[model samples]
Target: MTIHSVPGDFHIPFDDLKVVARGLVRPECVLALDDGSLVTAHGQGGYSIISSVGEVSHHLAHCDTARKYVPNGIALAPNGKMLFADLGNQYGGIFSLDRHGHLETVLDSVDGTSLPPSNFVMVDEHDVLWFTVSTRNVPRSKSWNHHVRDGFIGVIDGDGARIVADGLGYTNEIAFSPDRRWVYVNETYAQRISRYPLTGSAAKPRLGKRETLVQLSEADLPDGLAFDVAGGLWVTCIASNKVLLVRPDRTVQVIVEDSDPAHVGRIAAGIRESSLEHADMQTPGNSRLGNVSSIAFGGRDMRTAYLGCLLDDCVRSFRSPIPGVALPHRSRRIR
Candidate 1:
C-alpha cells in the first residue's frame, strides 16, 4: 500500500463535554429526532429513545430475523423507518425499524458471502446506502491482527450491493463531503483518516485516489466521524478519549481529550452498571464525559453535538461553534 501524506500543524484544546443521560448501556449511535429527542443503538442489543432530560422514553429489541443482532451505527429513512448495521461473529446484517416499532432484516449477505462485522452506515442525498465492514473476520477482536486487509466499503441501492473499495485497515465510520465530491473514512486499526475523491453518478459512484488526512499514534483508535458545514471532519477516538477536527486544508485540531488511556479501555469493555465504582473512577481534567464511540450534530440551528459513549449510560453533548451540515433523510416530525 502506498502512503499519501499531507502536512499541517495545528492543535486546539477544549474539554467541556457534559453527560446528557445515564443508564444507557453501551450506546453506539446517537442521532437527533425531529421532536427534540435523541435515538440511540445500544451495543447489548436494541435501541433507546432518549430525551434531553436524560430519560429513556422508548426501547426496542431485535426482531426474530436477527436473533443475535448487535447494532453499531444507525440512520433514518425518509419515511421514518430506522436502519441499523449490526455486528456479530455468526451473522451480521442490516436491520430496519418500522413505525410500529418492529425490527426487520434488510440485508444479511452481499453476493454469496455473509457480512463480516458491519460498522457504520451512511445514506447519500441520492438515497444510495453506503456502509463499511471493518474486517472479514467474524469476531471483531481478531481485527487487531493487522496482517489481514479484508476490510471493505460497499454501497447498496435498488440495483443491488457491491464493494467499492477493499483492503482497508479496519474501516469504521464513513462520511461524505457537502458537495459529495469526497468521501472520508476512519481506518481504526491504522489510526489514520483515509479519503478518496468520489466521482460518477449517484447511482454508480466510484472512489478515486486514496489519501491520508490525519495520522495519530497507536494509542488512539478513530471510531466515528461527522462533518461541519465548512467541511471540517469531527472524529471520535475511543482509546484516547479524544475528538479531532480536521479541516479541508488538512489542518487538524484536538477538540476533546480527557481520559486515562488504560481506564478508558476498561470503560469500553461494557461493564455492567452495578459494577461501576464511582469513588475509584477518575475523570481527566474534570470533564463529565469519557469513552465515547460516535458523535452526531443536530438540534436547533444544527449546532448541538451529541456524543455516543461505549461505557457510559448516557450520551454527552455540547454546543458546537459551527453548525453541522444537515444529514440526508432526517425526519422533520416524530411518529
Candidate 2:
C-alpha cells in the first residue's frame, strides 16, 4: 500500500501506505511512543505493541483471565503507567494497565454509580486525563443507537473524577486544539465533530457551549480525531471506511476512502458482532480495510500518520501534507 502526495480537488489520495502488522485482534486506539513503538488497545482484553515497521511485538499487558476488560482507548502517562479505557461490562471504566498486566482502577464511578463502558481517552500536557463513556444502557449494543444520548465526557486530574460534559451521541475520540483554546470530540452516531470552548485553567478547565464544527454525511460515522500542524482535523470515519479533513473554517474534505468491498464488509460485520455479542473477538489481518478506529502522527519529522483499525489485521500508514501537532507525550515511552 503506497500512498502518494499529490494534488486533487475533492481529496488527496492516500497512497504508499504499508501494513505494519498482521493478525491483530481488533486493535482499536493506537498511540506512538518515543522509541518508535506503537501501543494500541485490543478487543481481546489487553494492549499490544507494534514495531516501527509494523511487526506485532509482545503484549504490553494482557488479561486473558479477565477477558471482561475490553481495552478500548489508551494513553501512556509520564509516570510510566498506561491509562486505558475498559469497555467491558463487569469491569468497565478507566484503568491503569501496568507492565506486569495488572489493572488498577482509575475512574470507575462518580458519586457511587458505576461508569458506563468507556470509549476514548486523552491525557493533556498537564497530566490531566480526559475520557468518554458511550452510554450506560447495555447489553452493550445499545450504544449503536443514534438516539442514545446518555454518553458523557469526564475529566480526571489531581483532584478527582468529574463529569465535564454530558448528553452526546456515542462519543469516540477527544482532542485539543493547537492553541489549547478548544476541545474537539467526535460524535460517531451523530456523524459530526463538536468543539467546546476550553474555559478556566488547563488543569481544571471547563467545557463551554457545544458548537458543531462539522456535520458529516449521514452515511459516515466519524471516529478517531487528530490535528495537523496547519490546524486541520484528521478524522477517521468508520462503516464508510473513509478519512476526512475538517479545516478551521469548517470546510470538510474527504482525504481518502477505502474502496475494497470485502474489507468493508468484514468491518461492518465486526462492528455488528461488537454491538450484539459484547464479547471477545478477533479479525484476520489482511486487506487494508477502512474500519479505521484511530489516527496518530509519528515518524522522524512527525509527518507520518498511522491509521489503526478494528476489523483489519494490521495498522496502515500514510504521509501527511503537514506535520501533526504533538500530543502531550508524543513519542515518549515509559522506561
Lowest summed lDDT window (length 10), candidate 2: 276-285
lDDT of candidate 2 over 59-163, digit per residue (tens):
545545645677789888877777888887655788887777776777879757888778887788887889998777775566664556777888887668888
Off by over 4 Å in 1: 1-15, 52-54, 62-66, 261-290, 332-335
Write down the RMSD of candidate 2 (Cα, Å): 4.8
Query: How far in Å is the alpha carbon of 57 misplaced in model 2?
Result: 1.8
lDDT of 1 by residue, 221-278 (tens): 6888989887788888775678778777766677777757566555433222223233
- What is every candidate's alpha-carbon RMSD to the true fold? 6.5, 4.8
The most accurate candidate by lDDT is: 2
lDDT of 2: 0.75
lDDT of all predictions: 0.73, 0.75
Top-TM-score structure, candidate number: 2
